[model samples]
Target: MVQNPETIQECIEKARQRLYQIANQYPDLWHPEVIRQSMVLDELINEYNQATRLKKTIKI
Candidate 1:
């Protein structure tokens, strides 16, 4: 699946917001699920950026 940069950015931002909310709700414990989701979001953002760069390089 392919995602545009803007969409990827939006998703990343949403994930970050959710992470913050989770942290606020559970100040004592670290939730593995939330952390994992954030990590996945980061990976997706990185992948999107790399794909965009590759596309630009190919066009050059």
Candidate 2:
């Protein structure tokens, strides 16, 4: 597994760049790999959003 990114946006951008590279280098294997990366990115974004929202609520 890859290490967790410091920020959600950065993680998603890096994953997308990797997905693009994989799609270009290995077209046949791109399908499964892209799906996996996309899922992970989605989860990271969701978790980040939730954490930020919780922090805001606590501050108020």
Candidate 3:
């Protein structure tokens, strides 16, 4: 079965939106900690994607 890129992109966007909503809910307590962790996680995800791209390019 073939998957659509647009559908996958939509799913990723929705997940990001949900994460943002959850992060915004702790307005009274630990807000800074939560935001900092979220930023780290986002950075890690970017790094992982870059590594994956490098691996694919190396294989070609």
Top-lDDT candidate index: 1
Residue-by-residue lDDT tens digits, candidate 2, 26-55 = 677548876786687778777667767776
**Poorest 10 consecutive residues of model 2 by lDDT?**
1-10
TM-score-better candidate, 2 vs 3? 2
What TM-score fits each model? 0.67, 0.62, 0.51
Output the worst ten-in-a-row residue range by lDDT, candidate 1: 28-37
| Candidate 1 runs further than 4 Å off | none
Question: Taking the tens digit of each residue's C-alpha lDDT, what string does model 1 give over 1-60?
Answer: 767777787878887787777777767445786677668778977877887887788889
For residue 16, model 3's alpha carbon misses the true position, in angstroms, by 14
Clashing pairs in 2: none
Provide the global lDDT of candidate 2 against the true structure. 0.70
lDDT of 1 at 49: 89
Descending-TM-score candidate ranking: 1, 2, 3
lDDT, candidate 3, residue 53? 68
User: How many clashing pairs in candidate 3?
Assistant: 0
Q: Considering lDDT, which of the candidate structures 2 and 3 is the better prediction for this target?
A: 2
RMSD of each: 2.1, 4.5, 6.2
Please list all clashing residue pairs in model 3, or write none if there are none: none
